[model samples]
Target: MKKFTAHKKRVAITTAALVAIGGGAAFAYWTSTGSGTGSATTGTTVPFTVTSTTATGGPLTPGGPSQVVEFEVTNPSTGVQRLQNVIVTVADEDGILWTDAGGCSYKDYFVSDAVFTAGDVAPNGGKVTGTVTIKMNNLATNQDACKGLAVPLHFSAS
Candidate 1:
């Protein structure tokens, strides 16, 4: 009976470890402070406007069974501002999506690949802009796709 109890303990410990390893960041966030509101891709109010957006180059590749997306932002904020270090989350009819750290090139990534500082949207927010690239392979590349698939990119502060 003692041996049986020991065996059960080992199994339980192993199972707990597997669950934790599988938890990943999503789990970490949940286990921690849970949910918190943050930034949106598009800034609003009379204070700021994204201004313009342009693609620096063509697709990174043949989509790599996934797509590498890039974003260009123009700051027109009338107040002091800095890029928010965070995770850009997108959810659509397909499901949820995001870029991993490897997909990130910018600094101040408190989570995933979110960049927090490029320039500043100060008393006269900088025309400040930068690029964030993420691979979208989980989505289907079928003939028929969901119309207006919503991608909500969220960010956190450093």
Candidate 2:
């Protein structure tokens, strides 16, 4: 009986050792490399809107005090827009290049362009104010054709 019991214990120990070795071997794996691909998209940029607000100096007179032309810029885009400068030009009543008539035209006026420090305008409804001086230059010739005529100004922003 003693001999039979010892043989049984030896058999169980050998089976357990075989299981531990086999279990470790079962987890072993081969290392290798592979690859694949991906994709994406982007958005678009738009222009700004400039509008004249009011004039602070005067009804222009030849060789008289210059008027400060006040204006504002509107950012209609969804993202912040960069503002660099605002340029004011004398436009016809129809907002185009003035045509010479009775000696009154764009050539008779001088406008100082307004420059701004580079700044970011907020998205949508963001506004910034600027001013340019407009003067009727004292020409050597007559400018009576401009008397009582409403000056139309065109504003642009960049």
Candidate 3:
């Protein structure tokens, strides 16, 4: 009985070794490699320009009506881009009344919504025009502080 059990264990070990060796030999015949070449293309970048039709605005009086500032933007990209929105930054060349000493707040002077839909500028070259209306605060507090103020308006689009 002991001899028979030893013989069975030996047979199992031999069978596993044969299966592993056979699997390895099968993969040995399947071995080859190849190479190829191709070209990679990239998208073209578009050029753009923004011109202020109303470059200089002033001589404005307090409690005045809205001042129309026009802007023309050009999109020269190969891809189509729409006039989604306009962003603007304002600054006074000469120092004006500080916020602590402020008479009229900037929000009071300028219209909150200055951007208008100017439509889409075509790709490869096209133009879109928009307007920003600025108004002066009619408050007496802003009378002296905002006098002869030159606020440079910077514009950007997404």
Candidate 4:
């Protein structure tokens, strides 16, 4: 093996130490801040009517098998538009909803901000309000199912 010069050895050791220290620091940050779980910065602010929000679905016991979120969107602008996309998330938890494709339906499941838009709000008397359902897997086994799920229904006239 080729022997490294004294200076070269010292430099190599220092670089290795720096890398180790950097990795440790990063790990510390992740645990301390819990920043990856639904960081507030990820939510999109879409306009829609603030209808009633209800938790549906899930197992049958005290716990349950899934959860459903229902909301209403009113244009009030008297225009005729359609609602598009749905983005639902839970804080500090995985997203538990069904909305992979783009359109208006309460059957598909998954987390999405997919584009819930309502466009035809007739001048001052146009409005649309409906219920959207979100399903959750075995809530009993997961226990921490709906921990960090936040759903903001976004829509526009189409």
Per-model TM-score on C-alpha atoms: 0.32, 0.73, 0.53, 0.32
Per-residue lDDT tens digits for candidate 4, residues 73-115, read: 5545434444554344432223233333332222322333322
Q: Write model 1 residue lDDT over 1-158, tens digit each, in one string.
A: 99999999999999999988887535333444567788758644433333223323433222332333344344455656655543344532233353333332212111136433554555554544444554323233331232223223442222
Give one clash count per candidate, in the order shown. 5, 0, 1, 57
Cα lDDT for residue 17, candidate 1: 93
Off by over 4 Å in 1: 1-48, 51-75, 91-112, 115-119, 138-158
Q: Which stretches of candidate 3 lie over 4 Å from their true place?
A: 1-39, 44-47, 55-59, 92-108, 112-115, 139-142
- The best candidate by lDDT is 2
Q: Model 1, residue 154: displacement in angstroms?
A: 7.7
Between which residue pairs do clashes occur in model 1? 83-116, 84-116, 86-156, 121-125, 122-125
- After the best TM-score superposition of candidate 1, give how far the Cα of residue 1 lies from its true spot, in angstroms: 99
In terms of TM-score, how similar is model 3 to the real structure? 0.53
- True-vs-predicted CA distance for residue 109, candidate 4, Å: 10
Q: What is the C-alpha local distance difference test score of each model?
A: 0.41, 0.80, 0.64, 0.44
What does candidate 4 score in Cα RMSD to the true structure? 27.1
- Candidate 4 global lDDT: 0.44
The digit string of per-residue lDDT tens for model 3 on 1-158 reads 99999999999999999988987784345678999999999776554567777633545677765577787778878777777777554533332422324443454465435466655778866777777767766764537766666545666666
lDDT of 2 by residue, 1-158 (tens): 98999999999999999998988775568999999888776557678887775778767898898888677788899889899877678886456877456668887789887845458999988988777888988999888898877677877677
**Candidate of highest TM-score:** 2
Order of quality (lDDT): 2, 3, 4, 1
